[model samples]
Target: MPRMTTERTKTTVRIDPSTASGEREALEQWLDFHRVTLAQKCEGLDDTQLRTPSAPPSDLNLLGLVRHMAEVERGWFRRVLAGEDAPWIYSTQEDFDRDIHAADVDTYEEAYATWQGEIARARTLAADRHLDDLGLGEHRTGERFNLRWIYLHMIEEYARHNGHADLIRERIDGATGD
Candidate 1:
């Protein structure tokens, strides 16, 4: 397949319309907002601008967060939901907090692509199941969790990272989160 030449945009999200009612809408909205917010942090930047670390000790950068998040999306949707048993691109069942490695632009692209693909897949999964349906999976512990856990977890993850990206983008080029 030909590689998509079009870059990501804050307004280009591909969320499907909801058939079920209730908190699914809020959860979906949060997910949608964070997706755009995440991309906003990445706006108007070249490779060099993206790679530069945000502040003093934190190694988190816009591109690196994208890389890390992409890995997370893949892990949850492809490996967990689909039960592929594939090793995680970020961490093969290890601590996901350490998945912030983006060595170069190519690495960022790969990671981001991984995330985008998985996001699409996860949305498909969500579309088929109502929010009440059990989404069986495990935490880092041996304990199992349901689909609700996954939805909440992903939203938390994205929101936290979007906060990080807010400061990083501002420092990078006087940009602010919307």
Candidate 2:
């Protein structure tokens, strides 16, 4: 699942596809829905509220989730799918989980900007390519993947993270629902 951040204005309500006519359109719509959902989950929260963990003995905060998602978006879209030499925005090789710890307002702002930028680049890259077009995978085996798979994976990622976000948001201030 992707992670989330704190400190966002209320997101515009998602306009779910009424009747997507093709695979690309359907995939894009679903992805966009999940993206908006994540933003909505973090709405009306300050940095401190976002940084509060979901439960004891857990570091899974909303702000950490946002930072983590930024890393995930960059890793998949920019680095792997786009074939760019992009690096992790928050985490490092020595500590891939670094993004999930100790965030502030500035960190939230930077992470949100980076995540949105990556999303824009991913959209642009997808617009120029066919779903069947392949990108080299970043794993040790050097496999390849299609844009379709990436879209599905991102949708799945956001869906899962949004579940966590729901719980965290409810715990934070009694806000809940799809």
Candidate 3:
């Protein structure tokens, strides 16, 4: 919830892994690539454009995706992986998709910073841990997952969301690539 003076910026191009030799290297590189992809999709958009929903019937928007991903990063990495007492980024007990409705410019800035912070923390927490190391889940099922599984899940999640971001971005400004 701390506001950062410097805002998070996205690279127009995503970095490709050239020497990902091991499981950890490959997973991390791919995940980072997807993260960059999502950021790239949202680059150069204004607040109103970002807040525009994916059509009349759907409520999905670029800024909403940004906020939602912030929550997802916090949930999986900070809360679940590191077992920190971190609260939800934007959601609540009453409304799970609250983050998805955030629309203002301030919310956009904050969400991007929060997502980047969570990504950094996740990287730090996973750096020393092996891929096979386990993290306890706080869900009702009481499940446990390995770092490798989390990496894979995150990659998938970002990939899927990046696809949505692509559609939303194109719809917003008719910009399309990659």
Structural similarity to truth (TM-score) of each candidate: 0.78, 0.89, 0.89
Which candidate's lDDT is highest? 3
Off by over 4 Å in 3: 1-13, 103-106
lDDT of 3 by residue, 1-178 (tens): 3222343355567789758368789999999999988888878776667777888888998888888888888878777777778888788888889888773435667778888898898899888889888875564367777899889999999999998998888888798876
What TM-score does candidate 1 get on C-alpha atoms? 0.78
What lDDT score is found at residue 59 in candidate 3? 92
Candidate 2, residues 1-178: lDDT per residue as tens digits?
2244445678568887649468889999999999888878877887778777999888798878888888777777777778888877778787778888753434566767777887888888788888888875563357667889888999999999999999999999999988
Off by over 4 Å in 1: 1-21, 92-98, 105-107
lDDT of 3 at 160: 93
What Cα-based lDDT does every candidate model obtain?
0.68, 0.79, 0.80
RMSD of each: 5.0, 4.0, 3.8
Judge candidate 1 against the unseen true structure and give its global Cα lDDT, from 0 to 1. Answer: 0.68
Span of ten consecutive residues with least summed lDDT in model 2: 1-10
Error of 3 at 104 (Å): 4.2
